[model samples]
Target: MTVDRLGYLGFDASDVDAWSRYANNTLGMMTAAKGKDSDRYRLDSRAWRLAVHRGEADDISYAGFEAADAAAFNSTAERLRQMGYQVTNEPDDLKADRGVIDLVSVIDPSGVRIEVYYGATELFEVPFVSPVGVSSFVTGEQGFGHIVLATPDLEKSMEFYVAGLGMELSDIIDWDLGPGGKHKLHFFNCNRRHHSLALLPAPAPKHIHHFMIESASLDDVGRAIDRMERDSRILLTFGRHTNDHMYSFYGITPSGFAVEFGCGPRDVDRSWSVVRYDSISMWGHKFISPE
Candidate 1:
């Protein structure tokens, strides 16, 4: 069985304090008290969508993919084993820590940890209130947005995510960098959200290039641009993507990787057709310095 959507993300951050301010003030996420050494932020009804643990890596530690139920979770774990990949069933204490009923992990070809499970803890009674007054985040069925990973072997990564994990190919983008050569980006979808994961063939210092979070309103995005500009964290100027048509901007996280904040991306449907694009964005998205 294919996974549901992008559930949650964990980051090993060097400075937890920086992440706290960034998540609260810059991204407008609600902070939850996880512990003194770690920080957890809520995006919707879910107990937490993103977690930051104190560490030196300052990159994505693990990505959690949700299964609709126990059956789906079991089927996915079995499918991974059949594809010649080792799957680990995590212990009870770890499951408690993650606030999930069950959890199994597998490492992708790019060496990023992938956690698959079901039964996430929801805090609906508590209600989500964005510190920076973001109206809401587009989560629920679409999951907790998407993640783009940089891998050395695109084919191998595609095989693992597509053939093994059951993610369908959404579209492709072959970007030409003049003398630097060409780079092909493959986007995959598990649900209606245009894409929940993407793969880029390149060498990078970190496992992840960026993770995207969608806002419910365009006004929220406009206000975020102001905050990023004040902090000089804008990594890529405002732009609309060519493939998914996401109107978003990239900003430097406390860690070195980028975070794409946007709204109003077209959803994938049964009538969707796979196509390739020559460029990454339709308009805007100019690379900018974070000075």
Candidate 2:
């Protein structure tokens, strides 16, 4: 019942070559091709944090949440079944692909695949080395970073993630100027990371809205923006979020979804009281992509 962190993410994209270039040249992720089609990218010591599998749909394939251990995995599976969700034991072949010891799988209200597991394979043989001259990534107990998912029905999604999954609510943003939009943002945290997952209004492409990766240095973000200008599509202009206080800019990936390269976000804890804000960002984060 205790979901620990936002573990690895598996995404399916048609163009693995494009993803490889963007990950290595721009984001500075340690990259390796998986099999003949898929490619895995590493931001930390973990075998892989993000997997872009070659597929027809350019969308998030599944999200893995780290459970405490074998006991936790069994407890979580039972908990989900008691809640009326179909929790299935992950097959061995899939486990090998995910690099996890054990896990249970379930589909959320929005039909997104969710896995709860422990023992992600950590690579001690080859340490993470960013080819783009960047320093270390902001990971560890926080996991890779936050991922935002779009759902048509917010209440159902909340019931699955918050009530069923038991992820801690970090904050909510009902930002409206006056006649402000009806869209609502719900941020959830597992460990110290401000939000491991966010449930947002589903506009279109009802998959992952974006996933974030934070840099230890602000200069790295600036450098990425410079690199993004030449090769990638810009989604959100440079901005700071009012809730997490993450200074970041959003760039469209080769798969056509956005990734927030951020820095210096405030950490959260049990004492962290959930608050509501009226704005998405404190300074920037303007919508740059075509609507």
Candidate 3:
């Protein structure tokens, strides 16, 4: 049994103040709680979608992928064990922290921590309203959105996500990054969303490249571009991806990793056929701010 959509992403963040502002003002995500050390951001009705922990690395902590239910979670965990992965069930407190009924943990071949779970606790009793006025986020069964990871061993990482997790190949991109050279981006999807996970294993940095959060309206994306323009941490200018057709821009978060904000990416279904591309974007994702 394969996992569902991308559930949530955690981070080892350095500056809570900067992230608090970036999440609220730039990305327009609602703040659940902000402390001196830890901060929680909410995009939808979920208790929290992104969690920032006090750390020095300023990298990904772990990415949570949801399972359909208890049976599916168990099946996926068992499959991992059978495939020689040392999977372990998380304790009650850890599950409580994640707002999930239960979870199983495993590290992928690329050393990325993964949490597979079911029954996420929703904040339905309390409606979600962004503290900073902005349009809603596109999340539900599709999960908190997609993440792309960079690794030195692409084959192993690809096997882990595909043969191991059973995600479908959405498309492949051979990006000609000019002076930076070339790399292959393999897009995978578990649900209707174009891609919940993408793999890039070359000149690999042991961190998540970026995560995409689809806005409910095109105007919301435009508003965010304005914020990025003033913020100075903007990484890539506004652009549309060729495969997913995601019109978005990338900005470095307080944690030093980029976050993609955009809208109107096409979805997939049973009849979808995978294809490869020469370019990652149709146009405009040029480098905007200093890296």
Ordered list by TM-score, greatest first: 1, 3, 2
Best by lDDT: 1
**Candidate 1 ranges beyond 4 A from true positions:** 35-37
Q: Is 1 or 2 the stronger prediction by TM-score? A: 1
When 1 and 3 are scored with lDDT, the better candidate is 1
CA displacement after TM-score superposition, residue 131 of candidate 2 (Å): 1.1
lDDT of 2: 0.86
Q: Write the residue-wise lDDT of candidate 2 on 1-291 in tens digits.
A: 578888888888889889889999999998854733468889988988888888878999899999878887777778889889999987988788778898789999888999888988989788999999779899888898989998888888887887776787888998553354567789998788999999887465748988999999999999999999888877889989999999999999988889999999999965789889988899988877465
Worst lDDT window (10 residues) for model 3?
A: 31-40
Which candidate has the top score in TM-score?
A: 1
Give the whole-model CA lDDT for all candidates, comma-separated.
0.92, 0.86, 0.85
Clashing pairs in 3: none
Candidate 1, TM-score vs. the true structure? 0.97
The weakest ten consecutive residues by lDDT in model 2 span 175-184
Report the C-alpha lDDT of model 1 over 35-105, residue by residue, as the tens digit.
Answer: 44468999999999999999999899999999999988998899899989999999998898899999999
In model 2, where do residues sit more than 4 Å from their true spots? 33-37, 175-180, 289-291
